[model samples]
Target: MELSPTERTRLRRLREQGRSDRAALFAVLGAGFVCHLGVVLDGAPMVVPTVYGFDDDFLYFHGSVASRSLAGGQTVCVTVTHVDGLVLARSVFEHGVNYRSAMVYGLPRALDGDDKLAGLRVLSEHAAPGQWDYARRPSRKELAATSIFALSLDEASVKIAEGPPGDGDGPDAALGLWAGVVPIESVRRPPEPDPALPGDITAPAHITALAT
Candidate 1:
């Protein structure tokens, strides 16, 4: 699906790097676990780091029922970014990061009853696949204590910067300094079992598959 751009999606710098594909937006979000949620609490701007999950058109998030960002019918901006590499330029001024980022704009509404539970399940499964089914489900009181919010993915923008360093042909190239791209990647480590678990209990296949 093609992404419909609003004013926010129009890139001023390196406009060519801006993406117009909805699939790219999903790719950036699915590759990362954390997002920065921006909101105005009271009279000041605040950014909170949290986990998020998304389906086809909606992103899900939750926190303690008392969180001000989730209170009322508040409009917010949510951003997810993943650093793919470091662009090492001969000149410090030309250095940059190879990355993918997305910004979503919407008013988040609270989900209750079955919707809340279902939203929570989406969030949990996205962050840690198979755990929702393997672990104990939340109780009535536990669900009551949590506050779930849903934001539409319809009004989102994506920007991706890839490839090697941009200064290879510039004046800085003559300096003889080593300048290229340093690729950055995320790898899963072997699962560390909890100390409190029974000796016979082992890591699930879903968990171990991350390393393979």
Candidate 2:
């Protein structure tokens, strides 16, 4: 499951933090729902924050038909990142963030017909499990109004940072300043009912589970 990195995706800054396992990449990706997509349009670089989903091989996301990045057969970079903690070091220069991140590089392909619908299902399932089947399906008109793109996950890079501060053995240790990790976590709060929702329509069990 080791990831075979392409020349463009190779680790340079923090080689020690780079992960070669493909499963590590998938794990980082699967734990998050939103990703920033980077592409170029009309000689200008652009990055769009969008919701995403993935299978074993491809990452899927959607945007408006007018999106400049949605053009067929364009190379794009997608990054998914989760901040785990703040790394406090004895010295200000050594302070950093503990995180898990992945960057994927590939040419995006447009999806249509049955493939498009299936991709949309994957996206919905990723954002909220069981919602695809629970919510009303998208009509043909809705599908026509959206643009879905898929990119292979085969070319990607993964990095992870954890534990306490990294300067324990360095000169900063002699400085005797307090240094440790401030852990961060994503906590799901109770679901807020929509004001217009019918009283008879209750939240589903999957949603209840998510809100815990």
Candidate 3:
């Protein structure tokens, strides 16, 4: 789908190279495990880190209904980002970061009953890949104890800034400052099973590949 003119212009870097398609957007969302949920509580803005998942059109977040950040039916903004590297150049002003990020703006729709249970499953799977299927399903009472919200991706933007710094070979290079890229990565360690669990327990495939 084509991005609105406003959206295209809003993202400074993306206006030139960022993608504005459903496929690109979904790929970013799938790779992300954490999202910053921004909500307006009593006219104040609050951003909370939370787990989230998404299909093609809507993104989902699950939390306690009693959460102060999500109380009532307040509007929210969600953002997910990956810091790829630190770009160091001869000039401090040219120093920057390489990253991929997405911003979502919408009102959260509360999910209850079966929908809430399914939303939780989606969240779990997104955070841990195949672990959702390997784990036991939630009981009816357990489902009732949790709350979930679905936000449409009808209005959002994806922004990405990548590649080497522009000052690497410019006049600023004569300054003799060390200039290079410092890559950042996220990795997961082996699972630490509970001590009370049976000794025969083994790590699942999802738990094994989380270090990426």
Give each model's whole-structure lDDT: 0.86, 0.88, 0.77
Residue-wise C-alpha lDDT for candidate 3, range 7-75, written one tens digit per residue: 423666437656677666787798777888877766777777888888777899865632566657666
Candidate 1, residue 40: how far the Cα is off, in Å: 0.7
Model 2: lDDT equals 0.88
lDDT of 2 at 21: 92
TM-score of each: 0.95, 0.95, 0.87
Candidate 1 clashing pairs, residues 3+ apart or interchain: none
How many angstroms is residue 106 displaced in model 1 relative to the true structure, after the best TM-score fit?
A: 0.5
Residue 77's lDDT in candidate 1: 91
For model 1 the TM-score comes to: 0.95
Select the stronger candidate by TM-score from 2 and 3: 2
Residue 83 shift from truth in candidate 2, angstroms: 0.6
lDDT minimum window of 10 residues, candidate 2: 64-73
